[model samples]
Target: MTDSTATRATKPFRFGVVAPLTTDLPTWRDRVRRIAGSGYSTLLMPDVPKWQPAPAPTLAAAAGLADLRVGTWVYASPLRPAWSTAWEAHSLSVLTDGRFEMGIGTGRPGIEDELRELGLPVTRPGERLAQVRETVTRLRELDGPDLHTPVVMAVRGPKARALAAEFADTVTFALMPGDDRAEMTRLVRDFRTDRDVELSQHVAVVGDSVAPFMASPDTDPAALRAADSLAVLPDDPAAAAEEIQRRREEIGFSYFVFGADFAEKLAPVVAELAGH
Candidate 1:
């Protein structure tokens, strides 16, 4: 299990880096090494289209690096068959020695639209949540690998959050514009019955205000869309980091999913807060 809960319960803070899966594997591994070396505990890579280069190869390649834990910032639940996702996750779990985590959602309109263009179901959140739950169950049944990887549910509404608390090991959210921190906290504190599960938070970059500080396109399409649409900050990486920090405090999100473009530029910000 990921230490997100332990970090939340005992530690003062938790930190992670968002890998730009868009880059080459070697480069992504190098960056993951740096982030892990810098004391960040987790690395998140979101899912995108097959044609779109992403962080999966890099995450698999970096599996042997120290004790770093790897996670998918998110994977579009409605795009592909549930079993395919389960098996893919099982492969990563086996490869990463159970250090892999996955973020899942019914998928946003953009993803649904894209998948529909390809003749797939654009499942609504309710149907998708049920499918996701089944997938998680099936993933747990895999025998060849350790299959100990956890699933972090990404959802926004009350019903979805409740489902996540019951089925997922962790509950996550993309802190888009107008996200309600108070509401989120309330939802988590109330809906969760599993004492073992943890809650994770995510935020995106909006504009030049925090553009340079962002890593790049390592995050999944849903998150990328959220960041592109909501995260508006200064273009200078440093300024963007500062702005991102400000927003983090404002929304009460400890786990941030950033782009690879702002990695070096935002390093200072992460350093100032995490010191790892």
Candidate 2:
């Protein structure tokens, strides 16, 4: 089975889309079919209640649809018990034939409504990060000693970033349009560990339309380009290659994710950066 170690050793500068389940089954199936051959390395969906479909079923559907790797953009650790969350993740890992990469994090702000709905406590960052620690440990145990389930830790703080460095195969940061190279370098430095961990940047690629859905509302594609945050090119393959080089040399980001708006537009960039 492909584990975290193997993934980090082999996977190159990869690209993925966090496609939302905003449409009906037939339409979603057609979209999935298109994305399966779009040169993306992974197919991920966010676990925001009511904002997107239930993560497990949606990810399982993606697994059934194609050979592309599947995972949650991240499931909030505090939302479900470690065992239950691990059970679902474990089942998906098996179902997807080791194509599952479990991305998890402490629940974000404004999760109080969801917590209230789920009868979960709205704990502080420390307790939530502890939940993340327990969750990753349980997932590994659930996957068994022989088969390691690749894990991704999405975090931004020192303590949570520490959890990611220790337990994850990849770590994703929600960078803003105004964030400079120095800040990004600092974040990578903070997230670095002796173990291999691919650093991922979730950038909003603008083509058809900017995804209003983003970690930060300020991630508008036009605004980002204006602010010098947009590095990869969607139309020019050479420019895309240049962006890939810059990412690797400047800050060591090997994985990049975009919203569904870039699904079709990201093809050229993905084709250019898929293997290299």
Q: How close is candidate 2 to the true structure, as a TM-score?
A: 0.87
Task: Flag regions of model 1 displaced more than 4 Å.
Answer: 1-12, 24-26, 54-56, 64-67, 143-147, 180-190, 206-254, 268-276
lDDT scores in order: 0.62, 0.75
lDDT of 1 by residue, 137-214 (tens): 778787345346788888777677667767777766544444344544454444545345554555445343233223
For candidate 1, the TM-score is 0.72
Looking at candidate 2, the ten consecutive residues that score lowest on lDDT are 1-10
Pick by TM-score: which candidate is best?
2
lDDT of 1 at 91: 82
lDDT of 2 at 276: 80
Instruction: Check candidate 2 and list the clashing pairs.
Output: none
lDDT against true structure, model 1: 0.62
For model 2, residues 1-276, the per-residue Cα lDDT tens digits are 223332345347888788878888898887877787988888888878778778888898888988899988888888888888888888888888889988888766667778988777888778888888888888888888767788888887778776777888888875655766667677766565667778787766553245645555544556655556643234455565677668776677778887776677667777877778
